[model samples]
Target: MNALTLASASVKSRPLHATLCVLAAGAGIALLCAIFLLSGAVERSFIRNAQGIDVVVGAKGSPLQLVLSTVYAADVPNGNIEADQAKRIEHDPRVAKAIPLALGDNHNGYRIVGTTPDYLSLYDASFAQGKVFEKPFDAVAGALTHLKTGDSFLGAHGLAADSDDIHHYHAYTITGVLKPTGTVLDRLILTQVESVQQLHAHPDLGDPDAAEDLKISHEVTALLLKMKSPLSIMSMPRQLNKTSNMLAANPGYEMARFSRSMGFGKEVLTALGAGFVALSALMLLSALASSLAARRYDLGVLRVLGASPFTLSCTVIAEGMMLSLAGAVFGILAGHGMAYLVAVNIDSLQGLVLPQSFLHFGALDGALLGMGAVTGLVAGLVPAVSAARTDIAGILARGRA
Candidate 1:
């Protein structure tokens, strides 16, 4: 019989042992696959969303929190800074662009970022529908916003446009819906910074009674600054902190900090996966060793019929290879399916989209499969060698004893 037929017969003859080997090998591979998929997806999402902007200027607090708040809209602002201070940074020779961020309002749980047209330019973004806000009360929605055509955002004060409501307010028109950037920007309701000031300042603006009593303080949550060169990156932050109450933090640095803090758990998962693979190899070795004992009489009949010791060893090794191949095949399919399901759910809730290429089982996957096969091959070697060294006379004597 051919090697394939022999291996199939061997597996079919010992169904329980074969099934145990398959499950052991598959479990190791499944965990490894999950680690690869999750890590790749998160890394790609972070890289894509964090491109362009170099420095974040905000009130003194946690640098990581400032990065998360400004870049992802994932947190509330630390504190407010003077808009004039932000504008000064804008006009600085070393500064390329500065985008103002005003916070304090939320449509449901999502934060609203009030910034200028420069903010959209920073992302190089475009609308999937409608246009940018043109007037004071107008607003633009992100891709994930549930607002539809002709929907209006009523101010917190319960007043709408062209109305004489008790409290002063403005009606924000839903002019545009941005295409999903797979970034935190996808979750924001963006409007001009001046517009937000106007909304909050409305009570004092037209009323002489309120205007005389108004002690106004126009402030912003943070500022996104792009530098002209790498040199300014070092000097600007130092100057800003020494010169003003605001602190400058590098997004890239804070992102690294956040990733390092988060990545420790993922590394632990990887170590656990590696341990499983090693344990799987050991289990396969034991299974082969045990099976050889039960098949001693059959092996003896084959040897008497002229099968060499080498041939017996080859048969045992072939069994190991067959099990590895079957496990790898099933593991790969299961891994890919799991990745697809995870990606779909994450895209729905987090807007962190992953491309098809991210989950491909290309070179890295092939290397893992090869390692599994090698592990299986090694697992059979000791058992195969022992089986070949077995003496038929001694076996018969032991049976009689």
Candidate 2:
């Protein structure tokens, strides 16, 4: 029989050993694959949401926190900037557009964002049902939020999903349901800035005079700014930080720093994956070497039956490749499966909707497969050489003895 048939027979003979090799290799590949999938999805989501805004002007605090809290809605705000002062920045010559965000409440787990209709235009958001909020206490629910048009819900006082401090004085009526944009907007409840102001100001609306006084001292969580030009982007943040109480942060710069900080953990996981892969290669080598020793007599008989030395060597190499490739395929599936689970179940990764496909093949996947195949080939080479150089007469004599 041919080298391929011989290779198949040899692998079939050692089911347990083959399975061990496959599992070992698969573990390594799965880790690497999952890392790539999850990291890419997170990076894309962050970058996409961070777009349109050149600078985020918020109350003085951690710039990264400001970006995360304002842009991604993943954290609590730094503090609030005076609404009048933020409005002055809106009229700045360098500012093309400024959308004010008033935060500090939630319904269920979704954040309630108070902003103008221009906020919808910034994200190119479209309505799936009804229309945008035009009056105080009118709300527009995100596609993923539980509320639908005409529905009403009282806002919880805090950002936490389980906050019991509900604003019973006023309930927000859902005027619209936004189409899913796969961005932060999908998880936000949008309403007019006045709605948020009224909710917090008139917690006890029975005191109308007290509520009016509170209205005069309005504050916004942040200002999402689009600059007039490239020069404005570079100059505006420095100007704002120096001249005003608000801190202006570049989303791109903050995200880059965030990515760098995250790189350390990624490197650790990658190193572990590499170690497992190397161990798998060594295990494969040991298994092949042992198999070669046990099959020397059979190989000798094959040589006598007109199989060339080249064919015998090829058989051993082919067997190694088959086992490794099986592992690679299984690893890829397992890795993406893990990533999918993380995307759906993890609240932190809720902003991103990862590819739900079972086998999402990409350039990195091909590289992984190639790495596995190469590992197998390298592991098999020594045993293949030993098989090719086998002394047929000596092997037959030993077998007869």
Candidate 3:
């Protein structure tokens, strides 16, 4: 029989063992694929959130927290910086623009940001419908805001408030809708920074601020500053810290810091993945060795029937190659299926209005699949060697005994 035919018969002879090997190898491969997808997705999410802003200046707290709160709209602010301070920082020769954020209230879980029209341009926010918040209390809704024109968002109060509550308590009009930015900005309720300050300023329970000038509030949540040139950023934060109560952090700095922490975890997980692949290889070798010990007489019969040592080696190696192919293919499908499941579930959970054209796939996924195939092929080597060294006479005598 040809090497291919012999290999096929050998696999059929030990179907259970072959199937088990494929399963074991596939499990390791699936894990590798999952690691690649999840870690990559997280990194992508971070990048998406911090796309254009060069530096963030906020109240003295964690830089990452400031980014999360103001940029991503993830959490409430710890404190607010003065509006004049934000404007002074904006006037720096190195500073291109500063988009001040005044945050205090929430429309449901989403934050309400009071900032200038510059924020709309800075974040590239557009109108999905209607326009930006033009008049005070004439607030524009985020893509995620539960409120519409006639509909009012349940502010701090759970139900629609009466005129007394609407005027004094935490309530806002849903005048316009922001286009999806695909970032945390998409989830905010945006209005003039003065409007946000007023939400907190009025002494009476029902009276929000009647003041039109924003300088009166004297507080803002954060400032997003873009540098004229990135090189100009080196001493700018030091200069600003000397004059103001705010702290400045480069987005690139935090991105690298986070990447190192993430990379350390990835390295540990990768090593563990490699260890599992090694164990699978050893199991495959033991199985092949055991099968060879039992089949020595069969090998001798094949040799007597004119099968050359080279053909015997090819037959055994071909069986291993077949198993590797099967295992790798199954692993790839399982991995892809898992990635799809995560993407689907995340979409549902966040209710993020992602555009159809936003999906990004790259060479990294392909490289991971290739690594899985290599792992499987490496696992199959021991059995291939055992089959090549079968001794006919010795096996025949041992079988006879």
**Index of the highest-TM-score prediction:** 2
Q: List the lowest-lDDT window of 10 residues for candidate 2.
A: 208-217
Tell me the tens digit of each residue's lDDT in model 2 across 1-401.
67778898888888998899889878898888888888877888888888898999999999999999999998899989889898899999889999999998899979989999998887788999999999998999887786789998998876988987777778999999998776788899999888888777766545434554365339889999999999999899988889877899999999999999998998999999888888888898999999899898888998999888899889999988888888888888888898888877887776555345324678878888998898889888999999999999988877843
Tell me the TM-score of each prediction against the true structure.
Answer: 0.80, 0.92, 0.78
TM-score of candidate 2 to 2 decimals: 0.92
Ranking by lDDT: 2, 1, 3
Better of 2 and 3 by lDDT: 2
Candidate 3: lDDT over CA atoms?
0.66
lDDT of 3 by residue, 1-401 (tens): 68778768878888899898777666666666656666666566567666667888888878767766676665555567877777778887788877888776666556667887887776578887777778766677777665565445534411121322332444567778887665566667778877766655653433443442233367887888778886867678766667667777777677778689779999887777667666766766676667666666777788888888777777766666666556656655666566656655673223232432123445654665566556545654665566667767777677733
Best candidate according to lDDT: 2
Q: How far is candidate 1 from the true structure (C-alpha RMSD, Å)?
A: 5.3
What are the lDDT scores of the predictions, listed in order? 0.73, 0.86, 0.66
Candidate 1 local accuracy as lDDT?
0.73
lDDT of 1 by residue, 303-370 (tens): 77777888788888888877866676666666666666776666433655543544577765786788
Q: Which residue pairs clash within candidate 1?
A: none
